[model samples]
Target: MIEESQPGPGETPPALAVSGLAKRFDDVQAVDGADFIVRPGEVFGFLGPNGAGKTTTIKLLTGLARPDAGSIAYFGADFTRRLKAAQHLFGVVADGNNLYPELTGRENLEFCAALYGIGRAEARNRVEELLERFGLDYAAGRRFGGYSRGMGRRLCIAAALVHRPRLLFLDEPTTGIDVPNAREIRRMLAGLAADGTTIFLTTHYIEEAERLCDRVAFIVAGRIVRQAAVEKLLDGARDRRIIELQLDTAPEPLLSALSEHFPTNRWEPRAGKRLRLISTAEIELAPPVAFLAERGAAVLEARRLRPSLEEVFVEVTGLAAERLSAEKGGRRG
Candidate 1:
């Protein structure tokens, strides 16, 4: 018998919850009945294409935009009704640089501290520590407008953390960051989760989501197509592997043997005189390899290809991963 999965020990009314969430812009339905639970200290990854309502959902959860339908709950409290009080529950870093230009990075953080009612001395110390952690200490004294894109992003993150929020909303947190800075940011996010901070983030990078998220939700055309624990998805894909064989010419007998042995498996043509075969864990390749050797087929490479997050996304959404790349390109253009 199958049992429903219950929330884990650390989850209590969820760190964040959205039920029947929907949003609209004129006639277009931007988000449709989205529901998810984010547990305390878990990194929940939200993924989708450009017009997939990811940013809209983030705005609603962060209270930047009001939802047309549905409710948001945080720690057993109503999120929309307790907007002011709920402000202290989260830190947010939006995709854009909505920072103060005239003020230095230190000054921006101090301003945020003041807004959070943090004492001057405590805020100053925290700001100093954050600067050191993000490797922005050298540029802390420089005006934010004069800082590089990466530095500005770091400053924005520091400002968001001024109040020591229990949850963090990171929208494209590594967008303007360099490779090293991106790694550092990922490390910092991991540390925050380790210390009991729930993180809700949206990223287009599949590998980043696979590395950072305990579970992920795939959104498309304003709806979530599927969600599961990362391990479960990978394990399911691992049960099936793809094997590609290169032959000088079409080996009829070997192909016939493969068809006979693995009737349920799929066979397709690969570029440059190669035949691709897909089989499940139950099928052993040793016999097939021997058959190929006898048929004068040379083994160029034999390896099991595990499905990636991108492949899973494509399978679920019936859309190309290239959509994300196109979105990034359009943004750049």
Candidate 2:
């Protein structure tokens, strides 16, 4: 179980906290002993491949499904026993738009507001405000079924915000949308975070998580492999720098010399004038350059490649993000 330190008097608790979170679907354990915390006003990302228990965990957290075991707390209060009571404090925008197809965009928001018991007049004002805020005012009167994929997603998000919940849960918000729309949605999420809304975002897009999340957790095979702040992970990976060198020819003696000189570094010979070097720690480039010069080898090019979040994900999960995405996409289709 993962436990958080007690908050000081009058201090705000974390936005959400979980300990020993586990769930199963018959014999399959979808989530196995997960634990994590989301601080207030930060965008926390939950990332994993297909069948990694991402959606199952979300369902358990949001009270859509009951967990087989674990505790869930929201804002320092125990919500595990009564999730419905805390539902008013957060909003959820599911993967699919669960809106009435025949209803107009404006009508959908109004309907959502009504569910929250907002006054009729207030609902009208709130619906209009959300339509404008989400750039759906131009299509406010159009039936939801008539809206494009991007527009439908935007309206769904707007509907989720009808009551102005302090916390927002987005499950694959930009999946299947066009690049322009995805970019726009990311901008809007940033704006929301700037306005002090705590966002829990689950996405397959590594670039999206790298750009938007303050912290990220990697899950694989129903277990969390790792969790950390994005910057720290990236910065720490600098030590394992990868350098690619282009040579005029592959010299067996030069390779032997490099092995004798730097036994810790990994060397890979590539086809046609290319050699790759992976170092576990920062090393002087001068030595390698001098060694090549001494061997009378002409260097065509040299470049250093920085590790990215995608690489980090692959390293931790032992699975390629692209492969995971493809598998999940096939299942969805």
Candidate 3:
């Protein structure tokens, strides 16, 4: 249990805080001087391209690995020095199946609770509740090794919550599951956050993060490039006034002529007749509409577009968001 070093009334401390965190493997720096604070009861997303030190950072935060240089605090108290004592404060959910494959789902949860020193009666009730809540009651007696990927993943999450940790650390929560299962897992995370559990998740799905996280941090090459509330990041994105045009003809060929007319704007072709004209400055529609008309290309539709979170990610990290999605076997979530 966490020590009762509570802050004075009305003073809310961050759920987790890190300063100057650094980790290295051989000659490569895995995590470089990372720093961030996680507020109470918020879903925080750590986003980055592959090899960006996201996994290493989570390991450090969860005490699975020691940092070469840094300070870590949990709710204002330094946790780095008291790692073992702080074990009960949070739970980790990653790729591996930590539960015993030989055991049944109910048995796995009961054993997890036992590890936390919960009483037998309490463990039984908690296990049953978790099994039902995760929709695993139907297969409670099934061996973990025989369970489907989605079922096992759900059980992994249930095992983490057996002790009801105050903070949860998850990595790529929905990387390889069916759409229905992924959606269910997202709903579980949303419910956890609503009930005041602080959640820190690293994900490749930019769409999922945008939908679920209260705040997000962009990490690149072992460093945290940016961290802010989702609304704040999107607000900055809103400043870019992109315009989308649906033309009668394929817009790819017209890019050259459009460039000559609107040299300052960037033209990108989408599928078929959809064209995106992106610019930071205000985009007047009349000129482009008139130009298209004069060229005998009908302007089927012309609408203003807001820069997407994926586009903003590319701007900050200089890495395409497609890389993350593509590696995860999905383009959107």
- Pick by TM-score: which candidate is best? 3
lDDT of 2 by residue, 1-333 (tens): 112323457867889988889998989999999888888999988888767888888899999999989999998899998999988989999988889999999888988998999999989988988899999999999999999988999998998889999899999888888778888899999999999999999887787888999988887878878888888668767668778788888855578788888798766665556776777888677788778878888777899877768667866776745665565342121
Alpha-carbon shift of residue 290 in model 1 (angstroms): 18
Tens-digit lDDT track of model 3 for 270-322: 66588878788888888988997898888898787657777678778867566
Pull out the clashing pairs in model 1.
Answer: none
Candidate-wise lDDT, in order: 0.78, 0.83, 0.85
- Work out candidate 2's RMSD over C-alphas: 5.6
Tally clashing residue pairs in candidate 1. 0
Better of 2 and 3 by lDDT: 3
**Please, what's the RMSD in Å of model 1?**
5.7
Worst 10 residues of 1 by lDDT: 1-10
Point out the worst 10-residue segment of candidate 3 by lDDT.
1-10
Residue 207 lDDT, candidate 1, scale 0-100? 72
Candidate 2 deviant stretches above 4 angstroms:
1-11, 243-278, 281-304, 328-333
Backbone clash pairs for candidate 2 read none
Query: What lDDT score is found at residue 61 in candidate 2?
Result: 91
